[model samples]
Target: EYVTPGGYELEKILNRGSVAYTHVNEVWPNVYIGDETAKDKYNLKKLGITHILNAAEGTWNNVDTGAGYYTGMDIVYYGVVAEDITTFDLSQYFFSAAQFIEATLSNPQSKTNKTFN
Candidate 1:
């Protein structure tokens, strides 16, 4: 049996874990979670990432890399100027993010494209 922890308990449990973040992580098939640096063209090409959804954008988080940054690359770019704070209502952007991921992974040509980030 599994019991869901309360907010405070869940927070404590999350804080207890300290896993280092990598440049990119493929948590699901053809879907990736990564930092700002992963937006590099060479790296995207290496990772075969045809689309990128910048969850945290603008100069707020020091990530000013917009669509212009990927000028020469044949990659689709989406951005959400999100603030990394508890008070920020990130849930508002959940649907948009999911849509972007679905579009990216659903590409008929994505499966054969294999690369790294």
Candidate 2:
């Protein structure tokens, strides 16, 4: 079985660097990782994004744009109500998140799916 590194070890790696501000990065073709600011409709249009997977949903320090938020837009949204706490066990959402992303990516009509991880 795989074990998560101890909190001290994880903290050492996490706190090694200061927080850096950056624009959304395209880690894969049509896939992105960015802050909540990337949810703007105009920006998504400009970037040619067709789908968005929000790993962090809800109103707590996260983008509040659920599916209903993009009314009349051609974009598709997938969301997971995730917390930023270390003890939250983010792994629980991994499979579902991957399935959503895969579905979007595999859709022949979907040219670009931008996921905000």
Candidate 3:
């Protein structure tokens, strides 16, 4: 049998760092995780972002950019309509999102491959 921990336990586990993150952080050599501020076209261009995996597709308080947002820029986009509620059951998208991130980083034609921090 398996057990899942929720509420504070989960939050605590997810909160891995004390330092405040900026608009975008290069989590890996060619991968990034960011907040809503990263949705800006200028920012994405400045970072040389080749692919985007938006976990919050239609949320108001979160990111709002969709596949159509990058009309002119050369970017690969993927989005999941994740809910901002406790009962949203986001586990279903974990695998697909991971796959997107992996593919984005593994892509040989990726624009850049350097992490600032």
Candidate 4:
């Protein structure tokens, strides 16, 4: 979460965008089946999230739990990689950050996109 200039709480940042959900397996953990009520309350539709990148293998089924509820949503699963902390490279993550900036600049809703640079 971030604090705006006026101190209002903003959405949490993820890959340079405001993420509606984080650590999908933890917070709302189990995917609820046969329940449209939860989706309505969560406001997932209003958030305009069009993709889901599942970092778990067997958990793909869990995301399927929300399938029919949303239209035109894309979900892809890339299995997690176990790595030692001592050898991790932080720079690799920056590419995603750069891509996020590009996405925001190209977004139709962005004021920056409307202005002439």
Q: How many residue pairs clash in each candidate?
A: 3, 0, 0, 0
Cα misplacement distance, residue 74 of candidate 4 (Å): 5.1
Model 3, total clashes: 0
In model 2, what is the error at residue 86, expressed in angstroms? 1.0
Assess every candidate by TM-score: 0.71, 0.71, 0.72, 0.29
Compared with the true structure, all predictions reach lDDT values of: 0.67, 0.69, 0.67, 0.31
Query: Cα RMSD (Å) per model?
Result: 6.7, 7.1, 8.0, 12.5
Candidate 2 per-residue lDDT over residues 1-117, each given as its tens digit:
345678897788569864355666665565767665446777777777777777767677356668897778888888778776778787888898788878877965563443343
Best TM-score among the predictions, by candidate number: 3
lDDT of 1 by residue, 1-117 (tens): 345568998688569875456767665566667774445567778878777777677676655677787787877788788777789887898898777777777775551121121
TM-score of 3: 0.72
Candidate 4: Cα lDDT at 9: 33
What's the CA error at residue 93 for candidate 3, in Å?
0.7
How far residue 72's Cα lies from its native spot in candidate 2, in Å, is: 1.1
Can you write out model 3's per-residue Cα lDDT over 1-117, one digit (the tens) per residue? 335666887678568665466777654566667775446788878878888777677746357777798888888888778777779887898898777767775775564322111
lDDT of 2 at 100: 80
Off by over 4 Å in 1: 1-21, 111-117
